[model samples]
Target: MISFSVDFWYAGIGAALIALSLLAFLLSKRLLKKLLAFNIMGSGVFLMMVGMAQTQNDGAADAVPQALVLTGIVVAVSATALALVVIRRFALASVVAALAAENKAAENDAAENDAAEKNGAERTGSDTAVSDTTVTDTALTDPNLNKNGDPQ
Candidate 1:
């Protein structure tokens, strides 16, 4: 009369899913990240299946299921390795590009400072100061200058 059913609850697939979910949560950041989330998720699914195998009838585990787990592990490991290499290369390129952009910004700032010093000298009507070529070039080429100080 449905008096006992603890074994049925323990043998259900929910328990297996819970264990796999825990694993996936832990490995989601370090092993998966943005590139290989699907691969990591597949590995979690494989583990869930393996856990389910523990509840096989007659207390016997099947070889086919175990073999599938091994195959999936191999494929997942290879995919994870390849994705990590690609991500590393991408990060390196990003760093190089960012450094180049920073250097360009610094050069522009220096040029601006030189132009400001030239303007300040001109505003003081000083005739004994050295002429700044960078400021003259900007005054001739830059649209931000006037007809006298920003002559185009």
Candidate 2:
């Protein structure tokens, strides 16, 4: 009679995980998902290494592969942390760029509106009446004012 053992199951699971990792890495576009797939593939490799180290007759596990797996785990963790840092920096840079673009666009629109108002006043031959309801930006009046509307 043939017997299926724990090593057999581990090997099967490891193979499946590796296959899934490849698929995930290939199909996913985001950095986080790719990192997760890489971690999964590493785990699968570790499991396979352990499974292969199992002795057939004595059923004893080898120490070398276990040590290697432990070392690999540490390296993987370090790599993941570095990758996360890089991703965060990239995300921050993207946000800063987007905000800068938005601020520039707002300044341009304000300039155009001011120019239009001046032209309209010139065409009508009269000074435009400043309405009480018109609210002006603090930046336009006092250069010393900070972004939070606080005096510098």
Candidate 3:
């Protein structure tokens, strides 16, 4: 029969944490949340390692596992920082692209408005110009008038 010790309790807690972290990572949609889950999982693994190291015997603590856990922590922090930087760059790029598209659309609308205004001014100017001949409404209504508004 195996006797339960403090190490056993730590191991159980560590396993539970690892399982929870995995669940969180799998169900999470956001990158930041996934990153957090990953960190939690790492912590659980470290705890498990510590518990295992303490159970080695004679009540002597092992230095190798402790050192490894320390190194793992440093690596985890570096990785998290890098991930954050990547997310930031992606967000900034998306914002820049959206703003550029908006500005381009605004420029196109302004150009169209200017062109329409110019065309409207030309039409108004042409309508006001005097002509050599003019036709009356009665001439238009009368079928006797030729195509040029003259009596047939």
Candidate 4:
């Protein structure tokens, strides 16, 4: 006959939680899902510590593991808050960068149209009018270009 105590069950559940959360963390792509998985992994670690400590002390609770878990919980909460702030800032930065790029493209198109109009007006009396086609040289316009006009 095989018997398992409550402590043993707790440890098993903790192990399972750790495994599942680890899998979720690895498989998830989004920052929020990864953060949730990290929190679940921390919970599993705390559960395992408490369960193992109790089992070792003959079903009696020990102060050391409990204290450690308490400290860990506080630290985890602080870390999670910090991570949320970082994720939000990163998301906002990405949006700002995309909007800036869109605005720059619009400005470029407007400048090109203005230049073409000016050229068309200047060439109105000439027999050969300037072509409407505009060619942009990315190498010349790239911000990363070095002082020597080479890509940095």
Q: Which candidate is the best by lDDT?
A: 4
lDDT of each: 0.50, 0.63, 0.64, 0.66
lDDT of 4 at 147: 36
Estimate TM-scores for all models.
0.48, 0.67, 0.65, 0.70
Residues forming the 10-long window of minimal summed lDDT in candidate 3: 130-139
Candidate 1, residue 56: the lDDT equals 50
Q: Write the per-residue lDDT of candidate 1 for residues 1-152, one digit (tens) a residue.
A: 54434333444444555565566555555433433545645655765565556545433666776798799889878877897886676455434433333343455566665443444323222323324542232233222333332111
Give the candidate order by descending lDDT.
Answer: 4, 3, 2, 1
- As a whole number from 0 to 100, the lDDT of residue 65 in candidate 4 is 93
Instruction: Quote the lDDT for 91 in model 3.
Output: 58
Q: What TM-score number comes out for model 2? A: 0.67
Off by over 4 Å in 2: 55-58, 109-152
Better of 2 and 3 by TM-score: 2
Return whichever of 1 and 4 wins on TM-score: 4
Residue 25 in candidate 2, Cα distance off native in Å: 0.9
The reply for model 3, stretches above 4 Å from the true place, is: 1-4, 109-152
Question: What is the per-residue lDDT of model 3 for residues 1-152, given as tens digits with 9 covering 90 to 100?
Answer: 86877776786788999999999988776778988999999999998888877876533677888899999999999999998997786556444433333343455566565443333323222433322221122112222222332211
lDDT of 3: 0.64
**Candidate 4 deviates by what RMSD?**
13.3
